[model samples]
Target: MSLYRVFDIAGTGMSAQSVRLNTTASNVANADSVSSSVETTYRARHPVFAAELSKAAAHQESAGVRVVGIVESEKPLTPEYAPNHPMADDNGFIYKSNVNVIEEMTNMVSANRSYQTNVRVADMAKQMLNQTLRLGQS
Candidate 1:
């Protein structure tokens, strides 16, 4: 693979991580939201990623990561007994969002780390290119 491909790969990685972080943030933000019905409760969302192959390279060579889609978590929503709450159902139960705050926090950290690593990779590639150019001047 060419050094230039590193830039493209790292860029795509950063982009994918950005989407992941956004979804994680959204999930966390709605973690405490309550609704009167299951249909009105917020569901945790997560970004789906897929590896794409580079057309310029061999079939097995990975081009970069792509976000296939965002999917809602299938976990059951938390039903709490809040008899005096405004959003309580007929049974005095309120459905809370399925978002797991701890899990979303973990995902946020992971996505942040991944994005930083990609940035470092791109920076190193730039430095290497600069040094190569300097070599011809000596």
Candidate 2:
């Protein structure tokens, strides 16, 4: 693989991490949200990642990460019997979001670490490129 391919791979990784972080934040923010119906209740979302193998193969390079889609959690919503709640249904049941704060926090940390790693990789590549340019100048 070429030195520049490092940048492409790391850039894609960073982009995917960004999406992960955004979705994690969204999930955390809606963790406590409640609604009258399941459809209106916020569902925990996660980004689906896949390897960009075809692109990498076409370029004669190894696969890089890509976010295929964002998927909502399939976990059942928590039902709270809060008759006084504004969003409570006729049965006095309010549907709380399935988002788990702890899970979201963990996901946030993972995404942050991945992002930092990608940043470091990109920075290293840039430094190496700069060093090579300096050698040519000298």
Instruction: Give the top-scoring candidate (lDDT).
Output: 1
Candidate 2: segments with Cα more than 4 A from true spot: 59-63
Residue-by-residue lDDT tens digits, candidate 2, 1-138: 778989989999999999999999998888889999988889999989998879777878756898889998999999999999988999999999999899889899999999999999989999999999999998
C-alpha lDDT of residue 53 in model 1? 78
Of candidate 2, the 10-residue stretch with the lowest lDDT total is 55-64
For candidate 1, lDDT tens digit of each residue in 13-122? 99999999999999999999999999989999999998787543666454998999999999999999999999899999999999989999999999999999999999
What's the distance in Å from true for residue 138, model 2?
Answer: 3.8
Question: Candidate 2: RMSD over Cα atoms?
Answer: 1.6
* Alpha-carbon local distance difference test for all models: 0.93, 0.91
- lDDT of the structure predicted as candidate 2: 0.91
